[model samples]
Target: MAAENQTQVTEFLLLSFHGQPFLFILFLLIYLATLLENSAILALVSLDPHLHSPMYFFLSHLSCLDLCYSSVTVPKILANSLRPQATISYSGCLAQMFFLMWCAGTECALLALMAYDRYAAICQPLRYAHLMRRGLCVAAAASCWLWGMLDSALHTLLASRLSFCGAARLQHIFCDVPPLLRAACSDTRPSRLALHAASLFVGLSPFLTVLASYLRILLAVLRMPTATSRRKAFSTCAAHLVVVALYFVTANLNYNRSSSGAWPVVDTLVSALYCVLTPMLNPLIYSLRNQEVRGALRKVVGAQGTLRLHS
Candidate 1:
C-alpha cells in the first residue's frame, strides 16, 4: 500500500525568495565575491614562493574546496530566485546534495588537520618541518577527500532510496539530508540513524580534534619564555580560530536542529550562513588577518600592475 502511494517526483520546488529581485541581486553579489576571494587565495598560494609551505598548501586546498562548495548551490539559488517558481530536477537536487556533503565533510576534517599542523608548528617548533613533512601532508589531505566522498556516497544513496509520495516541495533553499528525510514518505529511521551517526563522526569528532589541538597549543604558548614569542604564536592561530568558530557554529546550528519542526526562515538563514556566507568570509578572514597572505596579495597586485605598464 505504501509502495502504491509512493509517487515519482520528477522535480522539486525549492524554497526560495522567488520573484524578489533584491534577493537575487544580493545572492549574485555574494556568489561573485566568493569566487573572486577564493580565486585570489588559490592564485597567491600557487604563485608565491613564500606560500609554498605546508600551511599554505593546506590553505590552497581549502580555497579550492570553498570554490567548489559554493559553486554547488549558490548558482542554482541565484537562478531560481529570479523565477516565478523555483525548481530543481530530481537528479540535479541529488547531485547538489552530494557535492555539498562532500565539501562539508572534507572541510571538517581538513580544519582539524590544519589545527594539528598549527599545534605542531607552535609546540614543536624545532621539529615542525619533520612533523609536517610533505608526504604526510599529502596523505592526510588525500584521506580527508576520501572520507568526504565515502560519507557523501552513503548519504546520497540513502536519499535516493527515499520515496517522496507525490510531495516534491523542499522546506529549505537547498537539498540536504535533513530536509530530504523530512520530505520522505518512507520510514526514515535508517536514514535518521545514519544522519545521527554521521553527525557524531563527521561533524563532532573533527570539532573535538580541533578543540584538543588548540588547547594543547594554548598550554604550549603559555609556557613560552618570552612575551613576544607568546604573542607571535597567538597571532598565527587567531585567524584560523575565528574561521573554525564561524564554520562550526553555523554548521551545528544548521544541522543539529530537530528534524520534526518546521522553521523555514531560521533554516534558510542558518543554511545561508553555513554554505553561502562562510565561504566568502574565509578568504577575507585569512587575507585580512594573515600577514604572509597580505604580503603575497600585494606582490601579486604589484606584478600585475608592472605587467600592464610593460604592455
Candidate 2:
C-alpha cells in the first residue's frame, strides 16, 4: 500500500507570496536596483585607480557575490508573483539550491577576509603591504571561492539523495536546504548532519573570525595616539562592519531557527530581506559611508559628461 501510494514529484509548488501583484512590482524594482548598485561597484573598483587597494578588491568580489546571490532567488520570486501557480522543476530547484549555497558560503568567507584586510591595515601598518600583497590577496580570494564551492557541492549532493514520497511543496520562499529537508520523506539524518556541520564551519566560524578581527581592530584603534587617526581607522571599517552585521543577523535568523514549527509570513519576509533586500542595501552602505567610493562615482560621472560634450 505504501509503495502504491508513493508518487514522484517533478515540480515543486512555490506557494509563498504567489500571485501577489504588489510584491511582483516591488521585487522587480528591487532587482533592478540591486543590479545597478552592484554593477556600479564593480565598475568603480575596476576603473578607478583610487579603489585599487585590498579593501575595494574584496568589495568588488562582495558585489559580485551579491549580484549572483540575488539573481538566484529574486527573479524567481518576481515570476512567481505574476503566476497563478508558481513552480520550479526538480532539476531547477536543485540547481538553485546549489548556487544559493555557493554564494552564501562565499560571501561569509569573503566578509571575513575583508575584516582581516581592515585589521592588517589598522593594527599592523608596518606589515600591511607585505601581509596583503597582490599574490596573497589573489590566492586568498581564490581559496574563499573554492571553499564555498566545495561546501555547496557536499550539501547539494546530500540533498539530491533525498526521496520525496508525495507532495513536495517547500514551505518557504525559495529552494534551500532546510525546507527541502522538511519536504523529504527519506531519512534526513545525513543531510541534517551536513547542514549542522556547514552551519558551524561555513557560517559560524567565519562570523567568529570577523568578530575576532574587529576586536583586535578595536584595541588597535584605542591605542592610536591621535583622535584623527582613530577616527580615520573607524571610518574605514564602518561600512564593512555594517554589512557584516546585516548579513549575519539575517542569515542566522533564516537558517538557525528551531525546526519544529512554521511561520509562513515571518519566514517569507526574513527570506526576502536576506536574499532580496540586502544586496540592494550593500552598495548604498559602502558608497555613503566610504568617501573614496563616492569620489570615484563623481569622477566617473564627470568623465562621462566630458565625453558626451567632446562628441
Which number leads on lDDT?
1
Best candidate per TM-score, number? 1
Query: Per-residue alpha-carbon lDDT of model 1 for 40-153, expressed as tens digits?
Result: 899888898989999888888888999999999998888888788889988988999999999999999998998888888877899999999999999999999999999999
Q: Give candidate 1's error at residue 208 in angstroms.
A: 0.6
Once fitted onto the true fold, the runs of candidate 1 whose alpha carbons sit more than 4 angstroms away are 1-7, 225-238, 259-261
Q: Report lDDT (CA) for all predictions.
A: 0.86, 0.85
TM-score of each: 0.94, 0.93
Candidate 2 lDDT: 0.85
> What's the C-alpha lDDT at position 129 in model 2?
99
Residue range 1-311, candidate 2, lDDT tens digits? 33333236688887656656677788889999999999999999999998999889888998999999999998887777778777899899999999999998998999899889888997889999999999999999999999999999999999888878767788877898888888888788998888778889999999999999998998988888999988887776666677778788878777777742287678777778877888898888755457889988889999999999999
lDDT of 1: 0.86
